[model samples]
Target: MKKFWLSLLSIIIPASAVTFEDNDTVVLLGNTVIERAQKYGYLETAINLSARKKKLKFRNLGWSGDTVFGHARSYFGPPKEGFDRLKSDLTELKPNVVIVCYGAVAAYDGQKGLTEFLAGYETLLSMIQSSASPREIVIVSPPPAESLGAPMPDMREHNKRLALYSKAVGKLAQKHKLQFADFFTTLGESKGLTDNGLHFTPEGYQTAAPKLVEALGLSVATGNQLQSEHARKLREATVAKNKLFFFRWRPANETYLRLFRKHEQGNNLKELPMFDPLIADAEKQIEALKKTTLSLK
Candidate 1:
């Protein structure tokens, strides 16, 4: 547990900037913007290159259309059930660093949902602190929605809401003494960044990857590695590992295998952990690919 001391005259201080130490396990959590990164693998590749010499592990737990309340994660259960699932996964992952990005979907609710968004986010931060006790927590604001010309309604008003939510995220980060990454301000509505003015395209993720690395206080000097065939291999391995881990934790047939209907298929529950070695093996391949690239440097 991290300790804090306060003087009668001083305000609460924020934690130091985020850094990826050797052997760190990082968990990326959020909604569509984050979940889509796995498809392109650019974000993780950028981070890996930046931490080339250091052996850092990344587990992306992003759920599409998720919110601070974990609404999207719930299946045949209440929001609390989803919250519990998220808590369990975080505890199991034992991440040294937790990066969270939200507010885009909630921002759609606009001002009426702002209070709930903040409260839910606070609850989430508390759960993360207690569940993982990570050395660092990074709060990332969602990127602004874009307008891709005809058929796409101008999203300037939506961007305003996002800006408001991002501001609140920054304040909350300070209150919790965590690091904040202002992607809303940093990657504001660039042309061709989003496919439908919301989700990022493959090219968009590639462009935004380095920006995310820089925002996390990681170096962008190895950014050129992103263009190499070696980097492609590393990214492919990363995607495979992510697929294995995803099925391990959030299997498509959870209802029959591990939930209320488990009486019929629960016997196969043992198959869940079977992915562990496969995931580990995939990670080893990724590390080997990264090392080969580094040796050439």
Candidate 2:
């Protein structure tokens, strides 16, 4: 009976893998643009849809306030920690598709300054493609951050640079024969979807997720009821687990959010407790699972 129950569980649960052959794994990496999706629960929505549609798995590695070039900078001394961590994170995640969204920070200079930014971005993509061997790579340009009605000094100039950056990325995608999602073009048409000229509202993600799906060519109907049912079950379980985790960490999250908001607004920094221990433990478990999944890919 125990063996029977174990077999039943195996049949019910989708295999934990990140490869294209069994499960579709997508990793979204960027700055605040990607953070907005996490905040608005769009990651959950996309994962559920993928599970329902194609039994796909998804992971997000987006960090707020990250620039295309910022990753190569050091917070303390030499040795770029951010970019190193990014490479490790990608290796651990081993996604089937990598969605790169960035440029808000890179376009801050009031000049046509995408030359260095694009070079760094291309390097990052090359590193990932060579190391991970994902089936597809998707480059999504940054959307227009809101103007915030205060007449930003470099808004127009920055936007222009972003447009050029988008074009460059499109060309790179073509050269690599990879798919590109024109988020900058699509999001520029709508001015109401941004919060403060950078982050996205829930509606923005609602518009963008389907576009991402279409770009990946995974939008076809699988017509598999069993897969749909399994995906629904997995989504429910993941959501329930997330809710519990959120409840447990709500206080810390709220405090962090408040401090994070202040930091983003260019306010003076304040002392905060180190989150490395807790975050590191969670990441270890996640990486272990991700590695097992990568082997499948």
Task: Candidate 2: give the clashing pairs.
Answer: 145-197, 146-197
Q: What is the per-residue lDDT of model 2 for residues 129-232, given as tens digits with 9 covering 90 to 100?
A: 87678887777766655565766443555566666666677777777766776666545445566655655676766556554544444442233421244433
Work out candidate 2's RMSD over C-alphas: 14.3
TM of each candidate vs. truth: 0.91, 0.62
Error (Å) of candidate 2 at residue 260 is: 23
- Shift in Å, residue 97, candidate 2: 1.2
Residues 115-143, model 1: lDDT tens digits = 99999999999999999999989998888
lDDT of 1: 0.83
Which segments of candidate 1 are over 4 A away from where they belong? 1-17
lDDT of each: 0.83, 0.55
Error of 2 at 294 (Å): 27
